[model samples]
Target chain A: MSDIQTDLQAPLQTPAQPSEDSGLILPRRSFLRGAGTLTLSAAAVAMLAGCESAAAGTSASAADISILNTALGAELEAIAAYQVGAESGLLQKPVLDLAVQFQGHHKEHADVLAKTVRSLGGKPVDAKKAYDFPVDKLKSQNDVLGFAAGLEKGAVSAYLGAVPLFKNRDLAKAAASILGDEAMHWAVLRNALGQNPVPVAFVS
Target chain B: MSMRPIAADAIGGGPRKGAVHRAGAALRRLYALPLAAAVMVLVIPAEAAAAPDPARGQQIYDRCLACHAVENNRVGPRHCGLAGRQAGGLPGFDYSDAMRAAGFTWNRQTLDRFLADPLGVVPGTTMTYDGIKDDQERRDLVAYLLSLKPCAPR
Candidate 1:
């Protein structure tokens, strides 16, 4: 589902440089801006819908197929969320760069999952071009922080849920690896939002 | 067609003996095929017990040796004589509370599990290496680590 959304949003174009006050690199946003309009390609959207259907237990093979699709979707969502933060002029350059780097990692993970799915005789979902977020609803710094925290929490849950379902050892390891990064992100975001750096005696 | 005298003779006498012999031969062939299949299945090797080459293990250990040392402490602990040593027992080294509390004695099996997923095995331990996935390589690394004896006092 998220993979389909991201795939539809691929080849993001670079936009004109924002004013100095923007204080962000916003690579993904700039690229999207350059593209001028957000278009969710028909095929990509169809694939995303199919992924959602599979996730909803519509078919006999839904369990495995849906898990892969959901993993891809979550990675895409993470990338999109990071892009939004970068483009919003709310974060510093270092934080923006970190988000970009993390997005790249998520992309790599999505690609791995896609390949695994194809290898297992399943179709990979496409990522959407533009994810619909409640950007307007995020009225304050706390709002942004909460959004990021939620994203990380969702990512952790998604990865944890998918871990047991993965039959391949490499995939399992990859999930575990990314789960750590997600925890790191959660910590950073929480600290930025003025929360405890380590919550509940967990590393995150 | 109606049975003739020859058919009657075959059913009643000589030909019956030949039919019985043919049936026995067919039965023997059927049993032999599955017997050969079973033998093939048994002969295939089990994956886990294959011996690791120490030389290859040494090469893989190079990545680990950067943070660890054979003789003494570096960025991490001295890995010398690590096998069979109690984890967190290195005197004077500051270990994470989680690592100390784990109270594990480092052996091949425990080390393998720890290396495979450090945080998973010991929740609060601080060792961050992503772990060696290849079974042979891990075995070899363990062998190499075990081979390093503590240096004698000057």
Candidate 2:
């Protein structure tokens, strides 16, 4: 499942600046970094009806759970990103509706990923109190749209990179499904900004 | 249930060296894709270009299953009866004003354009999805949608 492992690990070249509270630098690189470091093998989950789990507290491999959590983390970041844009009051009416709707989608993604992690006997990752979004850079609606669009594109790439690495085919399939959604988000945001919605025939 | 903090520092700093290295290799691979696709296009069998395959469209439809279903709606309208049905015509399905007023019927041509660019076709529609970009994918997806027979009312 390392087919897109390298691709997923490719960090976007954004101006790196540390968040005041977390002291972590590179907002764009933060979420995208998780999928790149996964070295886990894809071992299938073996579930038993109602028994105490064996190794790792459950039938699912730690690696699979880790992958889901990593994806979950990215989804959380997306929700936060949209929240920043939505609350900025920069977007007008129609764009605001679109952001809210897209944020809802991310929330759905986060909820499903969290439930899946729990189903696998793994603790889901929590969203950070604040993410290292470039608030200073988001001065206008266009800027906010561009910022959100970048995150969506990164999400698409991250999921694209992750889909092949999942040990569970179902998880991979789920990730691909979300990947499509992210791609659509990217295209829509780009369209909103008056850019080519479908710039490339094939998504990278 | 208890939750753990994301290792922000670990993600932003430490492993990035290796990630940056891998990214270089990945970029090279990405750059080569066009050439590979070109070769693939040249070698694609003629039959491969035959009428859109509903089977393949069905696979592509997996992406849409998150928001839609053949029999019922989730985030979007129920897809059954999509073919030749009025745009936003489903009863009781709350559609965006843009969609409700789209005033068009779903057919091969209309579906193709809409699938290619939903917002472009109906700006302010709350679908919030980027239409399918690939021409063949849109056609196949339209084929799959058309193949679906209208399901019974819920």
Candidate 3:
């Protein structure tokens, strides 16, 4: 907890410059290994793989459901990002703990949304064991920071988008609450990557 | 001779004794009535003095309502009927742990200072809105916010 707190409070350090051949930055196998503890069933993975097909057939109502699906998607992505960071053994204990805590938070959020969708007579979206991040092939702390920053940015946007869409006040408030935490996560990641923690205004 | 003496004593004592007892009771009642009246008069003013002006509080809330709505989560916490409420009592908004632990109630004086500079009063509050500078404005906003009763019967 102290380590997490320190990671949260510590000033942003500058990220090292990206190495040449950044295209090969994150390799597929290494990226999967970095994302921790994914146990998606084969059927679930197949379902997710059919998203483009499912999306093509979706109606307006399905679009609404898709918002939740998108949130779940972002969570899956974050879980993968955190697992990669945690498994790499590159981050200090404190940074790794913070990453792990956020991973748990994302998992909790994903679980709640999944239950909500199921209760609403919809199938929950499947989780992903691996994701495509460009920085997996890079060997430096800077590259990892870049990946985390991008992941946090996407999560923040997803939460913000979902907040207004929730009809239930309790759910809206809950989303807002989570949004604040996601915002903090974004700040911490940006700072870690040597960017401004508190931008003049919210970024996106 | 004994019966004759007892009868004479009872008849002579009755009217005179009853008048004296009645007069004493009347005087005691008069004293008690005034004492009770005095206590009531003293307590009423104190009660009125303690009750905040909900109207004025509404005016003070204008400064806050810009960034916050009564029920909506915006840049800051909701200010609807905040008088005498505990800090971090609202659900779902992730307040700083310092704010959660801070046991301050939102009475007039505390609110006034807080509205003036939230970070100064409660460090690490995410509210970036600068505090209201005018003392009278703060008072009015407080009055307005207090007017909004949270537990009003539906």
Query: For this target, which candidate reaches the highest DockQ against the unseen true structure?
Result: 2
Residue range with the least summed lDDT across 10 consecutive positions in model 2 chain A: A43-52
Could you tell me the TM-score of candidate 2? 0.44
Give the candidate number with the greatest lDDT. 2
State TM-scores per candidate: 0.38, 0.44, 0.39
lDDT tens digits, residues A1-204, model 1?
343333333442222443434443234334323323322233433343334333333332433554455466556655676677666655444445655665665666566657656655577757666555656544443455566666665455345544554444444555566566566566555554545544555421
Where's the lowest-lDDT run of ten residues in candidate 3 chain B?
B1-10
lDDT of 2 by residue, A82-142 (tens): 8878887677666787788788777777777777777678788787665555565666677
Models sorted by DockQ, best on top:
2, 1, 3
Q: Candidates 1 and 3: which is better by TM-score?
A: 3
- List ranges where model 3 is wrong by over 4 Å: A1-64, B1-154
Q: What Cα-based lDDT does every candidate model obtain? A: 0.50, 0.57, 0.48
Candidate 2 to native Cα RMSD, angstroms: 23.1
Question: Which tens-of-lDDT digit does each residue in B47-130 have in candidate 2?
Answer: 455588889888676555333446644334667667777766776665655455565567776677666655455544444344
Over 4 Å off in model 2, which ranges? A1-60, B1-154
Model 3, span A66-125: residue lDDT tens: 445545545665676677777654566445666776677667666665665554446765
Q: Global lDDT for candidate 3?
A: 0.48
Candidate 3 lDDT, B9-103, residue by residue in tens: 00000112334444343234324544785799977773333444656655334333212445443323555556667665555444544355444
Model 1 chain A is weakest, by summed lDDT over 10 consecutive residues, at A32-41
